[model samples]
Target chain A: MRRQITGFSNPTVKHLRSLREKKHRKAAGQFMAEGLRLLTDALACGHVPQVLVMGEQRDPHPLLAKLEAAVERTGGEVIETSEEILSKITGKDNPQGVAGVFAEFDTSLAGIDRSAANIWLVAQALRDPGNLGTMLRTGDAVGAGGLILIDDCADPFSVEAVRASMGAVFTQKVAQASWGEFLPWLRSGAGQLVAASLRDAVPYRGAPYAAPCFVLVGNESRGLPEDYEAACDLRVTMPMKGRADSLNAAVAAAVLAYEVLDKVDS
Target chain B: MRRQITGFSNPTVKHLRSLREKKHRKAAGQFMAEGLRLLTDALACGHVPQVLVMGEQRDPHPLLAKLEAAVERTGGEVIETSEEILSKITGKDNPQGVAGVFAEFDTSLAGIDRSAANIWLVAQALRDPGNLGTMLRTGDAVGAGGLILIDDCADPFSVEAVRASMGAVFTQKVAQASWGEFLPWLRSGAGQLVAASLRDAVPYRGAPYAAPCFVLVGNESRGLPEDYEAACDLRVTMPMKGRADSLNAAVAAAVLAYEVLDKVDS
Candidate 1:
């Protein structure tokens, strides 16, 4: 059934706005996915959208029919809303005219036993949502065991990250935990730890990555915490040839992920 | 001298908004750079901002004084305006409340002769500004000879790309040319042409990167154009391990860039 929602004061719109906050996303165990391609990918992955919000200004994009078909199969709810309501929900100038609220996948590394050959990515306190998304994308592409988010990082489900990831967010298993919560896993004798740092680090490719190891990337501004840096067995750094001191966080992660993958494949 | 510009109608503010259009940016030969770090990097790179504008509500950022000093040394102009005016000029949120209008650097690869050892990135019709920016940043880090922009790509100078690049847009020498214009350089007999495709191509690492080769990255949706793909001597593909049929554009480019760099460095 299709219904029109015009007022920003509507309860459905209010609930959508709350999804933007991390606390709400966690408490509800759901995150909002915007843009047509992402929603379609989620449906393809067998994740059902609980609610579908359509912007009133758009007569429904060409991809809407595919989404509608998926909704029918999943037995989901469809809510049509005005452009003003979507703009407020997104907090942006342009609304893509479609959004889906999907139950967040329970991504936990708890069951997987660490091994000497398993590769993992440890993202420490990255603040940019887009960078985190890109990191997850690269991590998934290289078949990393899992992505471990430690400390104060951006919300992985923020619209920007989801968009930047280009559907990788749904496929990757990302486990978010505090340093204390993750300490036991880090100490697990399953793999070596390779910390990425500018100081006291050898060239990334020069470091031995044949062993199962976790690549630890630090915050956007401050490098990784001293404890994490000191705890690692290997410190690897990318060689900088230009005047720019460092590459973007996502770029650095990709280079490292590819290096690890290439080493394993060879 | 510091002056208060109260209204959007003010001459300076009007001129800044005009820059939102591509025609004005081209005619003035200037582009906008945002955030404190990027503006500072531009100054350090010896490119002065023609106009520096910031939000009036917030206290000056620490780098603002340094920017003022740099502007004074370079004989440039700085202006303070309300947050609303800044919002009007950038057409994007100004959370940092700092932005600068920089004179675009006119770089051409015309006179430089290509050798078999040159590592080049050819971006063919990329649509996302952030992806383009990240690609440019990665290209610079991996020591690509230069970035060659093909037809129908996103504007490298757009605010999103500039911010995503983290000032690499200025640091990397990028030359824009159409397919016909780029044909001569590709046929110069200096390097192998490797196109990245998802077809029956060799694994990227196994593919012989004989330097002086140009790595071709296709559009976000269509991949590379048929003509460009046909012109390539070798096609290399990154082996995928997951459900994702392809990788992010920037991530793909970074992987290829690193592989090429490793080949040359070794």
Candidate 2:
């Protein structure tokens, strides 16, 4: 349906603004994403926004026309509102010309298809939305199946994360589960659980990596728990040649993901 | 000298707070850093803060006491102030109880030693402070000699960049120059300018990489100028299996830096 929202206090605008917070997003089962390019990428991935809100001042683009048609064809709501309301809905001083409301994807462990790709990215207790999103982008770059968030990770649906993903949010799968749930799920499937550890491990460069590898990193500061590292089917170590003892969680995941990608392929 | 500043309006507090701004920091040639650990790391690197401010109700630690003595020994100023004032100076809600003012280090292109390490990182028109700091941390991870900012990049001395660097800012060298200046400088020394590109490129895996290798990346949104790519000694492309076009700038640097490190060391 086509509509227009001229007021910032409109019920639709309020509902859209509510999605910016975690509890409201959980209640509505929807999350907000901005930027025309991001919504376009989401369309390319066969995911259409349930509600599309655009600033009336937005410059016309053919790609945006395609996105609007796809949303309208899917029985989605398309609302053109004043730029001020758009900024209010996005909670930004200078908002992107477009924003969309998408229902949260299936993030359950059982939903992940292990056979989809040769590499995967996983994080435990990741607290930063930017880092969480960067890992998703890294997974997309390395052809990883998805990112599995373990135990109290920053919400991947948060606006900060979705923006940082740079459209990877739509391309890569995302799964969330506790350690107990993820460990058993992996064991039941054809996968290799690998982690960067300082334990009895091999160098990350030439480590014997197998297909369907899961690259796991831990909390930003504490790193992987001792038992978690011990449980890995294979543990690899990246060289830390400076005063800082560890790499940033997302950067570490990307480096390890590329190594796994290079190794398993050869 | 030892002193107590209970008032937020104190001139020292005002000056320290100003360091949070780029213009003020440039005028003062000093930057503010918070967190006892970061200050300790700075101290360990023989960089005693010229002005050390502590929260009045701060916990007592041996390391902190050592830091205070070192500041005093170095003839630097040490002040105990209210947490509110500390927060005002650090521009953080929950201040880490300690903050310091350190003079900005030399970021001249001539100061870098080409023979310092096997790998180096370069960026052209990099905008984000977090990405700049992450690149510094990645450089530290791969034992890269330093990070060279080739054009208009984020200020390395900014609070966000320093905090994101996780203390790598002190360990790794930093240099800033225009593209015109950087090209001639690299040519004058033994360094390979490697960038992630698809133009006449080879697979990033096992590509011929040489030390004193400089892995260059461009702005976050715009990958790199075509002319810049044409100038690279080696252009490599990492596989993109998913829909997203590229990796995050810092993540790309980390991935490429590791490859260069692995290849050159052998």
Candidate 3:
């Protein structure tokens, strides 16, 4: 059923506003996926929203109707809110016409089907939400089986990270673990682990990446810890011919991911 | 000789602060390159600073001495101000210890040595400063001869762009021209023009990228205009196997740039 919310002080409005913070998102086990395209992508991925919020000025579009039907089918309520309310809920000057509050689906490392999973991207202490999200999108692009976040990484469900993922947040299986926990899980899987490092590594192009591999990227500033780099099955370096010592973490991940895909396909 | 200015109201201090804006940078024909690494890169690129500013808390170091000596040899002054003054000048709560004001070097298409220049990156109406700068860094990493910004692109000298470039702004040749102007210059050069487009394009890996090629990338939102795509000698598309319609502009550029390098080297 569709409900009309005329004021910002409504209880539902207050509930949606609280989701802008990580604590509330965690407590509620939900995150806000804003904009029309993200909501559409979430629905397409079979992620039904807990609540759908739309601006009062939103036109009667087929996509919006489809989203409303999806939410209704899932026993969720759709609320039409004024622009001011929508903006307040989104913490933006002008919020997109639609936003969906969906439940978080964090998977465990043990839950993944090993037979179907070939490649995994493991990011260690990745601090930038945008970089983490872009890696998720890139991992999805290259058809990686899953993403593993290790030790003090940014929240994958954060608004900035979700926005940067461009809907890959819905399709990609995200697993979180500590360095110690991840090492054992990785060893049990028996996949080749390729780490990108600048020190004492073979050229990335020349590295032989066997199947069922996990490509590990390091943090933005400090990079992979020395112990972690040493632990990997193979260490590879992307050539840097310019004055800059390193490439952006997300860019490095994309390049390496595509290269891995090429090698696997060949 | 090294001189120190302690006041926030000093004329040199005011001049350095003005460079934060594009208009002031244009009027003075100079831009501020912040942080120790950027200043070092500028000096290495033979760009003698007009002024060097440092926070009072900065420790005396050999690198500082070398930079001061270089500035003195070029008839430039080195000033030391309080942390408060440096913060105000940089618009950051905690500005880097060192910053340099250097003259802008805008190259023209006619000035480039056609015989020596093998690859050039052409960005049309790129809006984000960070994306533009990342492309510059990637171009530099691939040993691209230069970067060409066409029509309504972000200023390369903007602080965000420069910081994102990670010193590539100092080493890479940057040229700016309108589409009308660039088309004629490109035609006169008689080099291959490969446009990265989504429509009716061959796979990027399979595309034949001849030497002395100009790889054209489009704006973040709208992408390349249809006419521009039609005008290119060849059009290539990066494979997208995910829900996202397109890759981030910088990632796409990096992937394509590396592919071009791989093809050339092989």
Q: Write the per-residue lDDT of candidate 1 for residues B1-266, one digit (tens) a residue.
A: 66678987998888888887778888988899887888887777777787888788868556788897787677778788888888888887645688889887764558345652367788889988888888777776777766778998888887778877878876667778888978886786677788888665788885788878788888877888777887887888886765566777887888787777878765
User: DockQ of each candidate's interface versus the true one?
Assistant: 0.47, 0.82, 0.62
lDDT of 2 by residue, B138-255 (tens): 8888888889998899999999999899888888899999999999989997988999986789988888999889999999988899999999999999988788778999999999
lDDT of 3 by residue, B177-264 (tens): 9999989888886588888888889988857998788888999878899999999998998767677768777888888877777766
**Candidate 3 chain B: 10-residue stretch with minimal lDDT:** B109-118
Q: Looking at model 3 chain A, report the run of 10 residues with the lowest lDDT sum.
A: A110-119
The sequence of per-residue lDDT tens digits that candidate 3 reaches over residues A85-169 is 9999988887888999998885577766545556778899999888888888887888887688999999999888998888898
Q: Where does candidate 1 stray beyond 4 Å?
A: A1-27, A34-46, A52-75, A78-99, A107-117, A210-212, B1-10, B17-23, B34-44, B52-74, B78-100, B107-117
Q: What TM-scores do the predictions have? A: 0.82, 0.96, 0.92
Q: After aligning candidate 3 to the native by TM-score, how far in Å is the CA of A24 from where it should be? A: 3.7
Instruction: Give the candidates in order of DockQ, highest first.
Output: 2, 3, 1
Docking level for model 3:
medium
Better of 1 and 3 by lDDT: 3
TM-scores for chain A, candidates in order? 0.86, 0.97, 0.96
TM-score of chain B of each: 0.88, 0.97, 0.95
Can you give the lDDT of residue B59 in candidate 2? 92
Model 3 spans with C-alpha error above 4 angstroms: A6-15, B1-18
